[model samples]
Target: MEKNQSLVEENEKLSRGLSEAAGQTAQMLERIILTEQANEKMNAKLEELRKHAACKVDLQKLVETLEDQELKENVEVIRNLQQVITQLSDETVACMAAAIDTAVEPEAQVEISPGSSRSSDAFTTQHALRQAQMSKELVELNKALALKEALAKKMTQNDSQLQPIEFQYQDNIKNLELEVINLQKEKEELVLELQTTKKDVNQAKLSERRRKRLQELEGQIADLKKKLNEQSKLLKLKESTEHTVSKLNQEIRVMKNQRVQLMRQMKEDAERFRQWKQQKDKEVIQLKERDRKRQYELLKLERSFQKQSNVLRRKTEEAAAANKRLKDALQKQREVTEKRKETQSRGMEGTTARVKSWLGNEIEVMVSTEEAKRHLNDLLEDRKILAQDVAQLKEKVESGENPPPKLRRRTFSLAELRGQVSESEDSITKQIESLETEMELRSAQIADLQQKLLDAESEDRPKHRWENIATILEAKCALKYLIGELVSSKIQVSKLESSLKQNKASCADMQKMLFEERNHFAEIETELQAELVRVEQQHQEKVLYLLSQLQQSQMAEKQLEESVSEKEQQLLSILKCQDEELEKMQEVCEQNQQLLRENKIMKQKLNLLQVASRQKSHLPKDTLLSPDSSFEYIPPKPKPSRFKEKFLEQSMDIEDIKYCSEYSVNEPEDSDGDGGDGDDEEWKPTKLVKVSKKNIQ
Candidate 1:
């Protein structure tokens, strides 16, 4: 019952835990959804900000245009606009950071929980970890939201600040537009004035000074054009030369590549040859070693043969001494038999014959030993010849030539010679052993003969001593021959060493010459390169100088053009002022002529009145009553004066003047039937005369 209660309790705890986990998961999902929504809102706001930024960019482009037009006064406005853009960008960055933080936090919190929940303990641990992560993420999200709100407030503040600037910028734009319009109007007026001046200048005859200036300007323009053509030709030539140089350089590069490939091929061939040579050298060395071993073996054999020959010579000397002792002993016995035969005649005869036969046998044994010595000397000569043949064969093999049939035959002969030598050596050893054994037996016999002849051989001992001296002389001659051979070999070695040293010296000289040639070639190359560089620099300098000259000529041309335009404008203004002064003078001359004409009319009227008064006094009152007695007075014609003629000519030359005739008032002629003298008194002459003015075209 107790176990069952415990199990029920555990089951209830597990259920409670699962309920808490489900609630946590639900809250997490809600937070995730909220974060996603916030991200969406932030993205939309960012898009709106991007649109505003694009508008600002357009404004920036306008400011840049103004700058290009040299509107320095608007620098401050451009700076303010740039500052606003920077502030907005900074705000957008901050908002984006906040949005990213908010969006990433929930995902990070969810990821914090382990994927697998294999046991209750693991599930509980995962839940706890998730809960902790969620709390941290919530705090981070709240901070991000606060940051975002603060950024929004800053943006609003910046927008408020930017509003007045935008208004001012618009106002500045309007003012600039007005200034541009005024400038355009002024430009139009100047253009019109220039056109009128140009027309006048073209229509009027140019003064001598102006004509000269125009001719000079044309000449200068022609010269400039010619220079430009020349420069262009030179540039074309330079371009062609540069193209040819490039082609040459390309060819040189190709040649260098070919050379490099050739050098590589040569190096590969040299390496292959060197490898082949090394293999051949190794074979030669092996052959030399084999020859050296064979020679060493031959030397050992020769040494052994020489020792055996010495031993045989000693044995031969010992046998000669034994024979000499036996000869002495027999001579003494012969002397005794002769004395005994003289005393006992016929019985001693047989004994004397036996003694003579024994002496003949000893001489035959000495002849056999001399024959054996001659055979051994013959064998030694044959061995030396074989050795020489082997040396020649080895030389042929080391010379790196294919062996001919003769050489192959010689190699076979050498093997045969080797076999023959070994066989002869064995035979010689057997012969030496037999001679040693024979010498021992002869020594024993010599000892017995020496005992027998001890009393009788003192006289023959000098001859035996002379024979030993001859043997010693022969051994000394052999030693001298060997010493002579050694001296000759030493001379040959010294000659070889000298030749090798000379070869080395010659090789060193050749190498030095090669090094010097390489250095000379390198120096020549360096000098050529330096010369090429100097030429290039000179060419570049010439090009630069020509360009500068061309630029200066262009500037001079512009200056001359400006000066000519200014001079033309000055000349035009002078002409206009002169024309106005001439018109004024013409008006003054016309006024003077009208005043003179009026003066002439007044004088004529005065003369006529004076004449009428004189006639009235001369006639009687009674005669004046008659009509037939009245006289008519005529006015004289006015003659043209020189000054008037001159003035009229001048006015005619200047402009055409038209004259109109005015009505002349003539004094009333006396009536034919007039009865009243009082009628003449009542008709007074009118004084007012109308003068017409001439119109000058």
Candidate 2:
């Protein structure tokens, strides 16, 4: 029992040790698991950041492409504008030459003389028409110039608008820079964390010795269990033997008790006989001794009586002395009480006098109760009057009568009035200030509205000019056959200049848009770069986390390997035990085979005896020896059934089953001997030989 308990304790201790190791391993595994989760999260974030960066890069490229296209358009527009300007300049020069020629022709016509009357009339009229046309063209040119000036003003306003957008972009860039700085700081922090995690991972590495130790411990435990099992089996056998021995011991004890009882009875009989013989002799001696003891006891009693009388005398004398001392003490106590009584009586008399004197002293108050009562009465009377006044006021309010007006107006002195005027002036000043502020706001609003109106007007002016151009085209087409070509040329020059101005304005707007877009793209790039840095830091942290997890997994793997080795050891022990059991089973099988052969021979002899009995009983011997009757009388044999044979044939190879089939057929023939032993043996062997031959064939 002690050994079993000790083994159990050892097992418990080993289990505890194993659990501790498992706990440590589990803790490491959990740490790894947590780190892996963190790594996964970081990976996801990194992927998101990468995706976002990719999207931003794509957008930036698209913006750049757009800007390039806009730049090309602007360049085209500028080129067209320049070409138009040049064309206009050329047309202007031609118009000036035409005007000079017309002026010179008129003078030449006047110089030619009035003798050619028809030529004079035609020249004068044509000259007047040309001058009128020139004047009209000049007016149109002035209008065009004014329109150009307005366009220039609009362009300036557009430039001013672009300035604010540029400022906004600059501010955005500044903010993005600040954000990038913050991201850099964060990245630095993350890097530090990653480094720390990496250090933790490095520090957490499991040593090879620990795993080896665990495996050794597991092997020892398995060995202990096997030993304990063997010991327990031996103990069981010992206990069985001990139990039989204890039974024999109990029977022996019963016989020993009977013998002991007989011996005790004999010893008791001898002791009784001896005690009676000694009692007669002791009685005679005791009588002699009794006489002498009675004499001595009488003397002793007389001496004790004298000693008691002496002690009583001594006690009486001591009691008298004590009584005398007590009497003196009582007298002294009486004397002390009398003196105390006199002093106490004197103190009581003095206390009574002091109490009387204190009672005789009276206190005087300054005010009389009657005066206080009178004051209280006066307050009560006043309260009554106020109550009456309130009642009257309430009644008047209920009757809807207006209360008497409080005349707050007073005749003002010059100083007071001056103060009042100053206050009014201050209020007026404040009002003026507010009005001025409102006017400023209104002016700003009006200016904005005016700018918008100008922009709208500028935008509409081109449509108006185009309409005018259309009108001019119609009019020119109507007069094309009649009008001089100079006027038409002037009109075309104006149209070209208008188109050039329009293109220039459009180019300016496109340039501004491209600038804004570029600024925006730059900000986006900075933001994306910051995000990428953050993602990289996160990725680094994740890598560190993964390393930690890998360390933890390695630790777990070592633990698992130890467990697997332990399991293998356990399996090996089980296999050894199974092998021993198989050996035992094989021995039992050999014995069973011997028993079976004896039973078979006995069965054959019984069959012969039954046949002889049947013949003596006048029954047919064939009937007793028939297969059906034999099967009925005999016990079942250990032969393989048809199903089992078929199953074995299907499961094994054909060659293996061929030999097995011979044995199987012989088992049935042996169980039901169809003839004598020799005949049966010969017949079965022949059949087996034929089957074997067929299998070989």
Highest-TM-score candidate: 1
Lowest lDDT 10-residue stretch of candidate 2? 359-368
Model 1 per-residue lDDT tens digits across residues 666-696: 2233321242454444333434344344533
Tens digit per residue, CA lDDT, model 2, 328-388:
4334434543443454444444434332222221000101222223333433343344345
Please list the residue runs of candidate 1 whose C-alpha ends up more than 4 Å from where it truly belongs after superposition.
Answer: 1-202, 206-217, 343-697
Following a full C-alpha superposition, what root-mean-square deviation does model 1 have from the true structure? Answer: 36.5
lDDT of 1: 0.52
Model 2 residue 127 CA deviation in Å: 99
Worst lDDT run of 10 residues, candidate 1, spans 402-411
In model 2, pairs of residues that clash are: none
Each prediction's TM-score versus the true structure: 0.24, 0.12
